[model samples]
Target: MGLLLKTLFYSSGFIIVWAMVGYPLSLKLIDRLYKGEQLKKDYSIQPTVTVMVVAHNEEKVILEKMNNILELDYPQEKIEFLVSSDNSTDRTNEIVTKFIKEHNERRIRLFEVILRKGKTNAQNEAQKTVTTEYLVMTDANAMMDKNSIKELMAAFTSNNIAYVTGRLSIVNQYVNEVSISESRYWDNDLAAREIEGRIQTITAGNGAIYACRTSDYYDFNPIQCHDSAMPLFYALQGKRAICNHDAIAYEKAGEVIKDEFNRKVRMSRIILKHILPDINILNIFKYRWFSYFYFGHRTCRYLLWLSHLIVFVTNVFLIKESWLYAVTFTAQVLFYLLGIIRGVTKANNKQLTMIYYYCMTIAAQWVGVYNTLTERTKPFWEKAESTR
Candidate 1:
């Protein structure tokens, strides 16, 4: 029993530490070894494209988003806008209608759903109405740069590339501990995507700003996350999904920790319920490099909470065996205790706050997994208030 507990403690601790630190370091090293060069942008090849914005009660930001789309550097004649409203009770549909009437020449079209389905369902319906060679899908709240589309389209210089996702920047106006931690997380995520793109292809796309070939687009399961599902589909079809760092979109980070935790919980359920069932993705022998990276970068991330929990429980059992184990066990307890203190006091220590946020996020994932197993979680969509 003692040997078994010690072995489990060391193994789980190693996985947790590797995922937290070694994974990012390894990406940086691999990027340097197999550096990739970007293809030259060809301004002459202007293909017709459709910009799809999936919205649900987004009246506050719809008008600004329309203006942003109209002001894009891409040719207006070649661009078509499709804004889908998922049975929004608010003035979201009216706002989109008004925009379409005002900008008739911009080719802006609106699709409304009487029954409220999720964003994925709305997007799946919108794809059927597209009449362009390329499709760009973005969130209604994401304010895109003038040259975002231009940069995204530039990556399609090769027919082998199926999709290209832009960088999503989280700009926090009222900076708090949660916002600071989230900003750092996104920066590291962007770096990972860029490195993965250089090595082979990115594991997933950012729905905030991503473009794909219209011919390659497929209807996604309404319950699945389009950002993850679409890129995985492209990979299965033997096509490349790369990140275009120059193409940028901006949105605010969640100001509240609870809101962020709920969002992660929702995403965790989606990954477990929908993503994991796709057995073809786990067949590493067939996909080779993509499968290796997908398991290491994405699968490991989703299972991190399990490893964290295992390390904690096993450390408790092994603390009496050695001083090293005792020290580790003490450190874990202290870290979590500090997290609890910060949570209760609403303190502003950056390092301590991040530790608290990480612990809470893991707890959220565990709750998500439990809810998923018990069939307590639903596929309904609710926009995070703080992010808006």
Candidate 2:
């Protein structure tokens, strides 16, 4: 019994460490040791592209989003602006129609899906109507740089490079300490994905700005988000889905911790509940590279809360056995105590709020896992009011 407890304690500690620090460093080391697949870059490849702005009751920002896309630097003859509305029962459709009527030379069109299916479903619907060579899928809230689509197109120099994701920046990072914490977390995430792409296929794509070939786009249900699921899908097909850091987009960060926490809960549930099985992640013999990276990128992080729980629990019983165990127990207690204080008092310390944000995010993953396993998860599109 003692040995079992010790094993669980040590193993869980390793998992926590790996998820926090070891994984990104290992990726860098592996990349340095063995340079992975290189993408052939030709900056002049501007193919016919369709920009699909997926919207769902985004009346507040739909007009701005349309105007944003219409003003891009891409060729007017080559770029088609598509406003894919997922049964938006607001002024969204009206605004889009007005924009189309007003900007006929910009080649803007609105496709309204009658069903209020989730984001992926809306993408599938949009793809069916795409007669272009490349399709760039982005959120209505994501404001792209003038050269975003041009940069995304430049990466598709090789047919094997079917998918390309862009860099996303939070526009309102200083809204509050919580926003600052989220911005920092996002920077780390973007760096990790960039390194992963440099080594091999990226583990996931960014929802803010990503482009894929019309022919290679996978048609998945609403339950599976294209942002995370498409990378695995392309990997299974022996294709490359990489990150182009030059393609930039900006989005508003959540104003409060609860808003961001709830958004993570919804996304984690959708991806964890169906992504593994839907893409056949366990078929290691066939998709070995994908299996390895997905584990490092998602599986480890999603299940990290379990390891943390085990470590804390095991340390409780082992504290009397050794001074090391007692010290670890105390440290863990203090760490969590600070997080609770941050929660209760809503502290303004940037560093302390970041720590609190980390803890709350870890807890959110467990809640998502619980929601998925117990069939209580809702895999649908429900935008956070705070973000809008």
Candidate 3:
């Protein structure tokens, strides 16, 4: 029993450390080896593309999003906007309708739902209005760069490329401890996705800005996260999904830690319930490079909380075995203690804030796991108030 416990402790510790530190270093080291080749521009190629924006009570940012889309570098004649409102009680529909009237162009269309279905349902209903060859799916709150659409379309140079996701830039307008840590998280995520895309198909797309072939788009399960579901669906069809670093969309970070935690918990539950089952397409024997990228960038990441828990619990059992074990156990306890302190006091230290965020995120994932096991998490979407 003692031998087994010690072995488990060391093994879990090694994995946790490797994931936290070594894995990122490895990616950076091998980044140049798999760097994606730049595609030559064909100025004469103009594909008809539809931009779909799904909103529920998004009156705050809907107008800005519309204006952003209208200003995109893509040809207005070749591009169309499909704005869907999922039973918005607020002025969301009215605002979109006003925009359509003001534009007075056949390019802008609005689909208002009377009943509150979920985002997936709204997206599916809106997709039927799309006659374009390419689809650009974006959130109402995310504003795109002027050339984002053009950059995304440029990647569709080959038929084998099923989807192209844009870079998500977390704009911390109101800088605070939570915002700083959240920015760091997004930076790391973007880096990993860039590297993964260079190596092979990326694990998923940023919900803010992503494009896919209209023919390849499918109505996903309402319970599944659209960002992950769409990418995995394309992968299963033997199509490649790449991220266009040049295409950028901006979004605000969560101002409050609790709001971010709740968001992550919901996301974790959806990933565990829906995304995990679809990962079989990334079989090592079948899809060699993609399998390595997916497991390294996503699967192992999802299981990190479990690895952390194992290390902590096993460390407790081996605390008195040696000075090294005692130090390791003490460090774990102190790190958690600092997290609690940062939570209660709301300290501004970047390192402590990151640790607090990490611990809270793990706690949130545990709750998400419980919700998944009990089937308590529903398909309905809840907007994080802090981000809004």
Please give the CA lDDT of all the candidate structures.
0.83, 0.84, 0.81
Top of the candidates by lDDT: 2
Model 3 weakest lDDT span, ten residues long: 34-43
Q: Give the Å error, residue 212, model 1.
A: 0.9
Error of 2 at 218 (Å): 1.2
RMSD of each: 1.8, 2.0, 2.0
Clashes in predicted model 2: 0
Give model 3's clash tally.
0
Give a tens-digit lDDT track for model 3, residues 125-198: 88887899999989898899998988898877778889899988888744898888888877887787777666
lDDT by residue for model 2 (248-332), tens = 9999999878888998887777546443554576677876656767777777776677889999999999999989999999999
Name the weakest run of 10 consecutive residues (lDDT summed) in model 1. Answer: 270-279
Off by over 4 Å in 2: 35-40, 271-291
**Each model's TM-score, in the order given?**
0.95, 0.94, 0.94
In model 1, which runs have C-alpha deviations exceeding 4 angstroms?
Answer: 273-285
* Per-residue lDDT over 292-388 for candidate 1, one digit per residue giving the tens place of the 0 to 100 score: 6676677767777778888889888888888998999899989999999999999889888889889888888888889888887765558888887
